[model samples]
Target chain A: MKALDSFNPLAVFVYFMASAGIAMFSMDPVILLLSMLGAVTLFVIRREGRQTGTHLFSLFLFLTLTVINPLFQHNGRTVLFVLNDNPITLEALLYGADAAAMVVSVLYWFRSFSSIITSDKLLYLFGLLSPKPALMISMALRFVPLFRMQAKRTDMAQRALGKYKEDNAIDFIRMKLSVFSIMVSWALENGIITADSMAARGYGTGRRTCFSPYKFRPQDALLLGLSLMLAGAVGAAMALGGLEFAFYPTVSKISPDFLRLAAYIAYALLSFLPATIEIGDALKWQYLRSRI
Target chain B: MKPIRNEKLRRTVRYLVPFVLAPGFVALGITVFHEKRYAFISLCIAVSAVALFATGFDKKRTGSRRLVIVSVLTALSIVGRFIPIFKPVTALTVLTGMYLGAESGFLAGSLTAVLSNFYFGQGPWTPFQMLSWGLLGFLAGILAEPLKRSRVLLFIYGIIAGALYSFIMDVWTVVWYNGDFSIKLYLAALVSAIPYTVSYVVSNVVFLWVFAKPFGEKLTRMHIKYGI
Candidate 1:
């Protein structure tokens, strides 16, 4: 699992996209539960020994989503209670629970995703597909810190010139706006200089190619293949109505058969692959250390 | 005659994406997927639309100076998102559109969402945010003459931009919740989202009112001085 981050950027990107896509699209209770467990486990493993508020926040969101749905959505067979001429249905409650689970699961997956796929990896991916946008993104990213520093400098200079007044909300806004305006001018001026220098250095005179340290290794190939296979199976099963569930007028029972069970297992394995890899790697490390 | 026929075919294909393919996706999502896959379908639509717009921008012969200026504005708007209760991203994007051009505006708006999400956590909502803000800038560019002509018109456009942004986001909310688009559920979501929308509108109006002249004058000055 530690090596997961070191794999080819495409593999990691595809794996996360597949997992998150399934998490969002599928409403099956079993699939959602698996996704939540997988996501939380990966998140906890990655952020070990830290005080994580993610679980708590996810819990709060889950409760709020679950409770809020019954208020607005009143279509169901079993009536739970009535508040103001609106009957809260058991179906709506269940639907809300599933929806909440799906959301929380997706949230955790993305949390782990952000930690794994850093800007460099994303840039590599972008550079592979489109060079110009990738260049623009890198340029924009570089400018962010430069602009921040310039904004600070501009603010200090203004203060030094006896223009610092934040006596009220309006005044505070004025101060910020003035600083931002000045920074924009500074940035644009500097940008033109940079562009002129770039042209002088013959930036656009040749085909652009960026250096990337990541190479497609055999392990990356294996990971990519496995993720694609699993995602494809799940997606195909879904398209064929193998894992369909109705939650509207009435909640449908899950009848587990061959294709349905296969899809569910495939999704579970796909989501848990990272956590499983982590555990395996840790166990191997501990065994080697004890032997030594 | 043959070349003219090919040109006519090319034009039809160019218009096909937005005119035919977009609505086709919606119809297919509703009829075939039975609306259970609407969220994914709508996400695909948003992603492709953004891709189309981006490719269009890339095809234009944008100078390195213009690119760098766009990057700078993108960075500023991204940093502006950290401010509490009010963000100048939209106002700045509109100003960029009005001064620099519509394509620059769109690029800045979309790039702000994508790059800032590095800190804010990327999710399915990123595409929707990019589309909403990008369109706001694009339209601002289209209406730049009139908007720049009058303060009242600019403020009105600001309000509309804010409302339009929030309402487009609500489409995501409704799709995520119900797994499809339902008018009743959409209305419910809109009602619940009123407070956020109102604040969005207020902040946009305030940002534009305060920052418009300074930013505009500087941008216009740079356009003449630096020729970017």
Candidate 2:
């Protein structure tokens, strides 16, 4: 129960966002490796061993993705060998590595985020999220499993109708063939049901309130305060553009190191926002229970 | 509350809508999509394909109402693609795909690309944009039915689709722009598209996992009722 409530969504979101901005600022393998390692460490501590391993594997994936075109690609300076007269240069390798690093960091960040945010928390964050547009989005997110279950059921039903095959690929192909019609039908019917549900619930006419199982206790206040501080720091850094950099022509000139470092510190602090919120809430609840 | 999806009105819309599309297609081609004569042809074919699909699948318990609702949903999903501030392509397309068929998702995506490129001074990308965005939508549409109800699965799908879409576009650019087709050039091509690919893929997941079921389903329902 503690673990369930302890999962932090904002921590995951900011971690990835910072990763995005950071990826642009620096394509250094070392920087990327550091971030990846940190993310892996968090996963391990969380007992998400498999995820840690999965993200850790990104280094290899980065290699494969980068090496593909360059080994086969034929671009860069300091050509190592001519593959059928195509010059494969060191520059291309570096470029590939850089691209790979960026991609992997982003991927890892996302994986971390998804693990933390549950469907229900997402709803609470967005509110019952029921303006027609909001509701549709919420439904799509919710529909994944429902649709999958329905599809599984539909497939079984279709198989009974003699519409499926046994071979894996063949079965897939067959299912794909018949599934479209049924899926569309279901989506439409569900769309109608959902719309009716919303209208029946009296949606869109006025400001609507939402009910959430989770709420900010004293910890929420602390978390919110910390989040604001982090934001303000990063905001100040950006206003002065302390984190800007230009590395082309091998002339790497990074801006005010102090501010950049400070910004990064703030970014790192924000990554703990969700965790802080969780722990804070846990503490308050624990105290209240003890009092009771 | 208001009946957004009326069967009779949907039936009427299917026949009436495609007629006005030719000019729109042409305009989309030149001014919007910015392609040559070939773009016009492809756009025409694409529009007809959409209309035919709507009518053909109309009676399969999947009436035009669903099609129309999902199409509008798909279109709305296009919002995130255009708005970088809250760019949630995964979330948007997942919702779109969940409701609309893969074909509709493809149609919406391709149409969005074609239409949106207009803002960028529509150039050679009309057909290319159509193809690239079409594939994304097609993928979303195909996966939407099964994944509509599962945010987790939908989010994952969004990630894969985003990467695949970027890969496809990279290949296209290499083929179109890089005449030599050498390994180095290919590597360079792949490398360059990485940022766009990553951003798009991430956004797709973020959007889908976060919004698909709640907002996606609601708008779709409204469209069914409103007919727009």
Candidate 3:
């Protein structure tokens, strides 16, 4: 759990921003596969032997998205099959797979992102710009989980009172609505109390001082520099058309070039840095324990 | 009291920022530039619009309080997404808009998307969700008087908002599939997405029917009590 959290917030934020950005922007299948591998590896390491059943739904979504594209889109030269006079092409199927990989990889990255970057880190990143909205965002993040708990509490109380019998769909919805309204009023009253407390504490009364637990250490700076350099190399390659692929007219073959290969390596390394770090750390701990 | 010299500037910004932000950044980012930098730029625009609306639309004295209210509303919308199929995010955003100003509504709606995507997933489609929901909230705020007075108008607006959200998302889907927007492909995408769109409309209407009146009354009472 503390594996990725050990890094500075700035480092984690930059890594994700760069990785997710590259994953979304790059259409090259090789780059997309690399990003997906990195994301899945990091997700596994982060969960640390936990059941991976949670990602099955996203996988199902990926398969559906992948299959839907080729069916709806009839393009490319190589016809795989014809259904209802619509030609299904290999290029379209490949393109669909590529897009699905991109989406699923981005989703996996976000799954790790929410776990690594807590509300405090998010506020710390945004608070530098405007403290009020930053505070609001952090408060909103806090209240999400709080209100979920409140909803459960209300549900239990209503059930105990024999008021929330789920006999029919309409009755169940009505019961939920009543719980929601109770939560709404509770949230509103909570807001007033918070606002009064903030006002009394002289919030927003001049320059705001923020206290952050994250520090930009030398290692953090090193990680930031490394990620930026790798991202810059990949971006330069992309701009130079070294990473372009088109599938609609025909599946264009990518002749492996030195520059493109180098860019791919750099991008792969950049994405895999976090997972590599966690694995390396775990190995070191294991080695030390065995020696002792 | 000294006369504020930036009154004209503030007034111009009050309208100009949202205009430039809601359409300009998102459209250009999606249609024109396929670069990674544009994605970051669009995100910045969305965040700035939220900040501007939170601060620029209200008096300074009430700013923090408004922020608190918007935050809570955003939180509620996020939690509202957890209630299975009939999500109340749209209803809550509209309620916020009807009670608060358009800017507050937009902020609440957009922030709700951004925040909840933390749990759902973040991708290129996130900004579009923010823009669509934010615009719905903004429009609701503009028609607040009528919406407050007429339940029928509110319901109609809810229906439209639901469809609008689906339409915007379909645009994303088409663009994502084809790598460029095409009318033919878009129509096909719309046809495929019909079932999802219908569900969106039904959920919006059902949730709004259930949640709006009770939520609105509480917000009104809070507004009168705290003058926020």
Query: Which candidate number would show the highest TM-score if scored against the true structure?
Result: 1
A46-106 in candidate 2: lDDT tens per residue? Answer: 5543664675587688787677545654444367777877787766666566556655655
Interface RMSD of 3: 7.3
Provide the TM-score of chain B versus the true chain B for each model in turn: 0.87, 0.63, 0.77
DockQ of each candidate's interface versus the true one? 0.39, 0.05, 0.36
Lowest lDDT 10-residue stretch of candidate 3 chain A:
A125-134
lDDT of 2 by residue, B25-137 (tens): 65544442121223234535454554444343433443334543554444344433556644654455445555556655655565455434433323333455566666666
User: Is candidate 1 or 2 superior in DockQ?
Assistant: 1
The CAPRI class of candidate 2 is incorrect
Candidate 1 residue-wise lDDT at B163: 88
True contacts kept of 1: 0.54
Candidate 2 interface CA RMSD, Å? 14.5
Candidate 1 off by > 4 Å: A48-52, A162-177, B1-35
Candidate 3 structure, TM-score to reference: 0.83
State the C-alpha lDDT per candidate: 0.83, 0.53, 0.78
Poorest stretch of ten by lDDT in candidate 2 chain A: A128-137
Q: Which scores higher on lDDT, 2 or 3?
A: 3
